[model samples]
Target: MNEIESYIPHFIVHGRSRIAQCECASCRAQTPFVTNAWSNQVRHSAQIQCDSVSREVLFERDAFKLHTQPSSPGDGEPLSAWQNNVNQSCINFLIVEDLSIEERLHATGVLLSRLSRDDLNESDASTPQSIGDELLTLAVSGVIRQRFSQMPSIDRYKRDYLRRLAKVHLRVTPDPIASLAFNLKLTELQVMSDGFLEDVLREIESSRQVEAFFGKHGHVWTNYFLHRCFHDVFPGAARNAYDVMFLDLCLDLFCLRSLCAFLADSDVELTEESVSALFSAWHRGGKECLGRDDHVDPLLVGYSLITRKDDRYGGCHER
Candidate 1:
């Protein structure tokens, strides 16, 4: 075999081992701190024809650790036992008591805005819909609405309805040319940066060629787990499914993850309405001008989402 051909198997083994270590550490933490980071690692590993290690080993060790943690003296309960005591009904009540549907949609919109493409945001002043504007708007709305369906009071039937609605409008065919162009542009952008994220992005770029399997299996693997992991994060409905699927395709992008972190860490209010109005402007492809009332604060929907998840874990109660 030629030198390049001979090196392929070695590269595959290294990538697979890197992914396994990340996954094992994340699972053992008993929290989702590294969930987003390592998720794409698994898919990239799969793309290189690396076999998936047994995931049964991932969580069971954590479960054992849970029981070993000492009980608090004041309450006479295990420190982590609050999660077991909190029921679905209680979590729903705590989440909805201070927040209305409109507020939830607004927070969801903020998250959607953060997730939108840099290209789309840039074109808002020029030609918007010439790109994939409407597809993203609708997908954000659809995912939010689907998340609400999981609540105890909401009709669970909305899940299937929203899924169908998403599938009907979202026909995301593989776009090899567009994907290649994007990666090429991304390469130009990352090469100029100097930081840890730049290094990670470089590694991902080097592995892109092996991701022929991504085109075939990415939609299933990426979306299924994202939904499962973020099931409780946001709520609302947009007008299209293609937008949602398109965003899903871009989930592993470093810019998107950084934007999510930025928004979540900002000081925006959870019940802000102007955030939704700004999202509406973006949804309309930014053709219309924003009024004085259209101004939105920086978003903290990520913080809000994380707070809610923790609230559910610590025994749901009014904030």
Candidate 2:
């Protein structure tokens, strides 16, 4: 390792222990990333060879997991295997819930490690499913929609969704943040000096304003949610199947831990005419413009394509 190699990981600003140690985009390629927010933020990186042949190199000089039981599969692996199986898993699960289906499919390698029923129904029903796989299953099952039912309180789902959503977007610019504030009617305080938000999800204070706001900023909300998701779940245990793959569900489960939280953390709910507009826009691939209405039910996805959609939100406009 060289002096430059040592400094690559330091460039990764926002991840918890879930952050990986590859130094791929950061060091070798000099990809820019934010560590803090303003003054402290600077560019940093490292690089590793990716085999075009895609071979696995391994050394077995250590006894890593001979005797350890930290409880659930989400507890994580024994040593430094966190990056590949864990971080990517969480990233993929969030992609399905957040970005355009195109982006999700595009980054399929970094995220979107799916598992099948035969994989889940394997001989190990004794353990809980992989959080990643489970989340994909949740997406497929549409179970997340239940949280959006006619709950007495609205903010329950709203705040949780916003909080998680904001973290995932990695939004540090004034324009997008202001745009978010304009749409959501939520306050946009500088949680991180350079317009980065971590601790406090700046939200506006009008429930009635959300419908219109959601219409225009669905992608914005999706970005925030996926960005925040990086912080919500961590490297715990390595999972077996897609259903339990990445501890990804913990964040959504974390979002829905309680009744009020469930109510507060509704799916990014989009309506019929709204979805038609979005689908049309999607079909056009941003070439042409549709109504500025882009919204998702304040939501979550994976497993069976059947279970991935929610019943509470059944209406949509055709493309």
Candidate 3:
């Protein structure tokens, strides 16, 4: 019989080895023997678990084996079938937390392989939107918890996967803007007392420390912070006049000129328009701003505005 097939369980009923021990120099190597025994114990436990899952036809042939089937072209299998197979495999392995790193990696590989560009895009479906989202959360929070417990730097692929997960979460949540705000570490104020906005405003008015902090990070962080504050006040409603005035005050404290620049460049146009027109434009623009890139650069906004202006004016310089 081969060495693997001839393997027997090691037991110590009363601290005795069943096998005969030859007192030679090699036999005296206690460390190696103990290490091998421990290694065998772990492997034996893993194999037993594998045996349980191996009864399933899908896993029986491929549990320990890497999937080498071509997903398209020469293979008759469609991409969706391959995706479903991979998703099922990942879900199964994810349920068993004690699986080896190889098994976890296999699950991760299959999950990643199943994703197409379409899976990353935002979807309005009531379902989870993307299987990759749940798989990623499970893999990180459950299967590989220990690996990321120390908070190591993630590689590019893992970072991209995390970004996709965040996008999906943002889309599915009741308050996507709030979801995004939390992800950006702007959630500190969520724990503050009932008079939170009052406290912030008072602090900003009373101290240079608050001003200095906002000055250092500039409008990118300021915009994010404002979004978090507004979302906390309004939850999901459109911003009203009070919201705009509060934003204007915060901007003015940061710098009056910056506030002026913001109003001028905004869609509201700051003209003698009716209150309804102004509020409508401001609210719509606020929603668009929340969904824009993190940084609030006037130059980039100006470029976009110029393109839009050209389209509206039909290339004519005159109004």
Candidate 4:
């Protein structure tokens, strides 16, 4: 093993590793170097958690540092402080938190909604709406930058197109939904704090404009999948759950489209048949592609076998 991989031993115990608690002098000296190197190494890769075991240790140290530091100076304005910190560390925030893109956006929106309730002077430039818009813009750009950080210039053309498409679909196409969501949130009529039932209810009971938009787009595959998976479990009065499900599917499709475009540009031949077969396996089995030490799905194994032989695609490993 290399010097970097050797550090993994210090954090491993009984075949499990925990990065948050390692504080040896050797770790203090070498952890940052390892993480920085691993960060570049893992960019745009789809390896499982085991592959990242060593890197996670390093990342946890950095996150611990960030967590210990005050989010902002002593201004005592939480929203303004978050705006400054997010503007400066948007990509880092996503990485350190290990949140999916959707989760990060939702979390940011929730924080914005809660913080916006604070009274602000009229002269303040960081109005709730302005700060929220800026935060959203930063979030999108940060994801794009991190996701495509290692792609070639040729593939980057597709990445740039995706960036624009994401901007339009996320920011423009969903305006009515955003407006309705904002109004519903202002009402604070939540039925439950932890479950998505209340959120589904929000979409179903929204205004006619929102209802019409969801109704028009309700025939998507995501709606079908959610219906198949969830209808029986929550059978009664859940007819309108498609309103929320299809919106989720729309966002997922955008991610899939972006992935396909990049892979195609990288000379990974993709046909309708192959794509269908891939998703078919995921549909029949499951889509939880996360890493396990003893087993990996055949789909990922095959893809990795093909990509690992060539340096063109980003990191893929042989188990």
Cα lDDT, all candidates:
0.25, 0.28, 0.27, 0.29
lDDT value for model 3: 0.27
- Each model's TM-score? 0.20, 0.27, 0.17, 0.19
Model 1: per-residue Cα lDDT over 1-319, one tens digit each: 1111111112223334544554322234332222111211111112211112212111112211111122212312221211111111122222333333223333334334443434333223222222224433433356433443343322122121212221111101124453344333333433343354334333433332213322333222222222222221211122122234222322212222222222222322211122222222222222112111211321221222222211221121112
Of 2 and 3, which scores higher on TM-score?
Answer: 2
lDDT digits (tens) for residues 108-183 of candidate 2 = 2123333332354324432233655655565546443332222233233334334333322211112454335332
- The digit string of per-residue lDDT tens for model 3 on 45-155 reads 111111111112111222222212112122122223332333344334333434332233333333433342245322322222255466656665654434323232212
Q: Whose lDDT is greatest here?
A: 4
Worst 10 residues of 1 by lDDT: 36-45
Q: Candidate 2 at 11: error in angstroms?
A: 16
Candidate 2 lDDT for residue 276: 24
lDDT of 1 at 187: 38
lDDT at 172, model 4: 12
Output the lDDT of residue 135, model 4. 55
Among all candidates shown, the one with the greatest TM-score = 2
Residue-pair clashes per candidate, as listed?
A: 8, 70, 0, 0
Predicted candidate 4 versus true structure: per-residue lDDT over 100-203, tens digit per residue:
33334233333333343437443453553465556556544665234333323322212222333222211111246543443333233223232343333223
Give candidate 2's error at residue 2 in angstroms. 11
lDDT sort, best first: 4, 2, 3, 1
